[model samples]
Target: MTAPRFLQIHWLASYPGTLINRDDSGLAKRLPFGDAVRTRISSQCLKRHWRTVEDDWALNQIGPEMAVRSREVPEYRVLPALEAEGVATDEIRKAVVLALAQALYGDKAEDVSKRQALLLGEPEIRYLISKVSEIAAAAADAKSAGEAVKTAFKEEKANLSSMRKNGVLEAGLESALFGRMVTSDRAANTDAAIHVAHALTVHAEQGESDYFTVVDDLARDAGESGAGGIFDTELTAGLFYGYVVVDLALLKSNLGGDGALAGKVCEHLVHLIATVSPGAKKGGTAPYAFAEALVVEAGSRQPRTLANAFRQPTAARSEAAAAALAAHLSSVDEAYGAHEKRHHLSLQPIEVPNSSRIGLDGLGKFASAMASA
Candidate 1:
């Protein structure tokens, strides 16, 4: 087998105030790491942020090619497309159910009002619409349209197979990167090319509770009580470490071997991670922050994470965390020989001895370098 080609992105971000990725009891998320409690943000939360960025990018960059994850595919997408094609209302409705069942559930799908929500990329949607339209055109009535849709399944099986083989059904950037799972049709599932780790604070710190009161201006004007509500919330402040790995080869394959598209994805992903802040109590705390330091590594070798550098938490306000991570990476490379190309970019001035350091202004250049790698 060919060696795995991967891109690993690591960063440190510092934030202040109460950002609650809460647990069952409504406290900030925390986990025990390296014999100390560290604030935690789930991978799911991180992925949600990244996916949202991806969605926005898709809308603005490639609107027609964007995929939507929803169960109302028929009502929202298929029906609208068929209607636009001047298909009768009744014919459109019948075609919607039949087409969805045929495309999603194959021969096993029954006539149902709703199907499970799944990621349907633009290519898949277009294909489904074309098939449904063809069936609708051949039928004399709605019932006949439904029957034609069902009969066309076996007749068009070869076409479906070819589409899958050509990766035509997996064209959207989000689907290609994040992957999709169709339990009803295993062949439609695409393996995820990206993996993100749970973000953790570089220093061990307990969350602090802040007690405050909310005063109502209207009540004050009406000569009411001084305070309207009083509540307490837990917050944490520290430098956080985040790590993500993307398999370049798998990503290319997922995008149907379009190198240019893969490059765009790589560039966008890096930009997103460096700029986007994960979800939190933004309305109250507004702990909006970006990555302070970013390290990107790309190569055809096994990927490694620099998380171990934080086994011993650094000072809260010191640059020791970033320094220690750089040192650790350098040490590893010295001992084992370098297998990947590394690039470092920072918002602050700090010397990472062995790495070619770039300023924030060069972020796009850094992303371009990684994509080229």
Candidate 2:
């Protein structure tokens, strides 16, 4: 196997008076790491934000290359295509639903329900529609078309290899990065190429409870007794550290060796990580913040995370945490000589005592280098 190319990204972001990620108990998620309790944001939350950003980017930049994750494929994709082809309104729903079931479930198609959602891309939709149309064209009537569809898929079930070989189920970039699993059909599964670590605070600090009251304007104007509402919420303030790694070789394969698409994916991912904020309490606290410091590393060495730098925790501010992380990384590189290239971008004016700094302008260049690798 060829050595895999990897891109490692680390960032330090500070939020004030915010519950960036909450637990089931409605408290900010916290974890006991190293010597102190650190605020934690789950990888699931981060990936959700990343996927949302990627989907928007794909729609605006790439034009319909992103997949839709839904269970209503029969209604949204199949029915629409058949309708456009002049299939009768009444016959379209039953025919397409039956065709989809057979195409996806084979002999067990009857057990499959139309309500089950699946992660499908446009390519897969088009392929299914083509097969259904072929069966429809060959049939003498609607009833015959339905039977022909079932028979065709039953034969396909007998020869699973031929079915898979002819299936044009192309995974989109988001699916390629995060992956998908079809319980009904294992062949549709895509292995994820990107790994994200749960973000943790760089310092240990106790969270604060904000007790405030909201008054109904009409009640207050009408001279109602007492306050309209009173409530309390838990929030924390600290410098959070995030880490992510991308397997370039796997990403390339996921994009079907399309170098250009891979480049776009890398670029958008980097941009989102640097600027996007996964505000957990979006409407209430509105903790919209971006990374204060970002480091991107690309190399052939085994990927490493800087989470250990926070084992002892740092000062409350981001600058101290950023410097500590930079120092720790430098020590590791000196001892192991691992990284091939490292680049830094700081939103604020801060200096790492022992590392070279790259301006934000170099992000595009770094992303290009990562994609080409």
Candidate 3:
């Protein structure tokens, strides 16, 4: 088995809202990023507010699925089959987990099954399903059904702790929110990966218009559509901050020794970013607000890596990153303060009306400050 790889974390900061005007039929509205106009995408005008909850659900659901999908089998399809057999959902859940564990984890399935049995003792149905998983795997391998069942029970009973411990390693950070059992086996996991890919694609298409609308509405409000092209599209600096733990060991185990799979994943990542970002030029100086620099750190904070924890900062590495963040924020704060004094404009955050669809008006405060400077 390949050793675990360091987890990578980053963020994608977004501006949210939908573009109102349509230029032509069947065509998405275009907007500017730096100097050139590109297509606009959006999630919702209230996108920022939704980010808090959406990430929680999306990450939890997607993480485990991604891990299991590494081994492609029809694991998810087994859930209803177990239910049809009168097996309890709890057992069915466990059984499918074991099946996945056996397929992806190989010899490790036995111990993993036992640990799950104990943790979910009351969920008899789920546990039963889990038992079935082992049975199915053994059967698939040409073992007698009775022998497979026997081996599953024996392994589960004998090496319960081993199962639990391995669960921690296999799950990494996901264990915290979803518990350390094979929630979805390899097949189910593979299905989940496909689902995540689709969801991300949908998000990107929706998000483009959101950014465009925010900028355009603001521009129109300020009447900055001057012939001088003050509101004309131009390349603007953008950034991405994301955090995800890529399970290299899991990837290798599922994808075989094909090292290209990892690179393929990276390429797909770039594609996803471009798809989501509206301002991305068709290969010019227009840069998408996705990833720029790549840095991976070793440490398990789970759902969130050490970098995310650094947002608040407690540990040494975290503190270092935090210090940098604080310094940057401070510089921006100082600049804003100077502008407020010189322009005599209120620096206070004010609520703007929702219906007055004007983008230019929003920058009024900033424009005043700039003139004064």
Candidate 4:
């Protein structure tokens, strides 16, 4: 079997009375579609919800080391490791850390460097700490310790450059999957292996402001009629259509050609996108809802969105949205002649001309076919 180059996941989730994503203006995010404005959720919000969840499907389980994004890596990670290596002089440690931080970030103090956050893998941090320790141990005082960092980096510039991709990872598992951009070192940048599209409602924005008041127990005890505070929050309800595309080859390469790990990651990702909710007001709104319908496609052709099916907006229901999706797929197939293998998992049946219906577990098996190839 020819390994598929891309695996695209499409789903329809119904979230009622929950503002999944909002704007700085304290309103539900909106997208202007063909004739109406639709409630929207940003890809960044979805990715953050997916990546940071410490659950059975967490991405952290995909590897031995995880990545930490912070600007104080030199001060926190590097200094601690150096201190343990008998670099007892506080002046030397602080001076060396400042120099290293400036190099990693820029030629600025801690305040400036604090603005530039970098995602560095634990392994990468360990490497940096070891190198910094070596320089610090050789220096006689803080002045020399600071200069030694610059001199060491200059002398080992060629060797340091290889750190960009020597281990086949830009930094760590998260970096390999989501990617990283280091302005100070352009060579360290890694392209994202997964691409996500912002989720948009299949219909025009369905939202309202919920006016609420908090009662003051003390005031009530004193027979007061006024509330402690009054506020209103935006709430939205609709069937959102979300899309995520995994570049198989790039994923395997990022994980050091471990197709098995990539396959496992793909399995967990499919489950998360289908089951996880990105709702904002969880406690009050209880925005817990799973995908009503999911469609997975594996193909070699360029990945395209089926969002146009709702260009004019569908009824505010899952069945209507799923039907619209299937019809659009059929039309696309009639024109392009169905170049991909597709599978469906849903509460209601959806028929794509050349597609197979599968259970949720079957979704993983279908995508994991790349591992065998």
Q: Which ten residues in a row have the lowest lDDT in candidate 1?
A: 55-64
lDDT of each: 0.72, 0.73, 0.32, 0.83
Give per-residue CA lDDT, model 1, range 41-79, as digits (tens).
888788777776644443226332667787666567787
At residue 136, give the lDDT of candidate 3: 55
Model number with the top lDDT = 4
Alpha-carbon runs more than 4 Å astray in model 3: 1-9, 17-180, 183-240, 245-255, 273-373
Best by TM-score: 4
Please give the lDDT score for candidate 4. Answer: 0.83
Model 1 clash number:
0
TM-score of each: 0.81, 0.81, 0.26, 0.93
- Give the distance in Å from residue 36's predicted Cα in candidate 3 to where it truly belongs: 35
RMSD of each: 4.1, 4.2, 19.9, 2.1
Q: Provide the clashing-pair count of each candidate structure.
A: 0, 1, 50, 0
**Model 2 lDDT vs. the true structure?**
0.73
Question: For model 3, what is the C-alpha lDDT against the true structure?
Answer: 0.32
lDDT of 4 by residue, 71-118 (tens): 888877888887787774989998899888877887775685345788
lDDT of 2 at 342: 70
* Residue-wise C-alpha lDDT for candidate 2, range 126-196, written one tens digit per residue: 76778776666566666777777767766665322233343222544456787777664666677787899
Task: Order candidates by lDDT, high to low.
Answer: 4, 2, 1, 3
At residue 282, candidate 2 shows an lDDT of 77
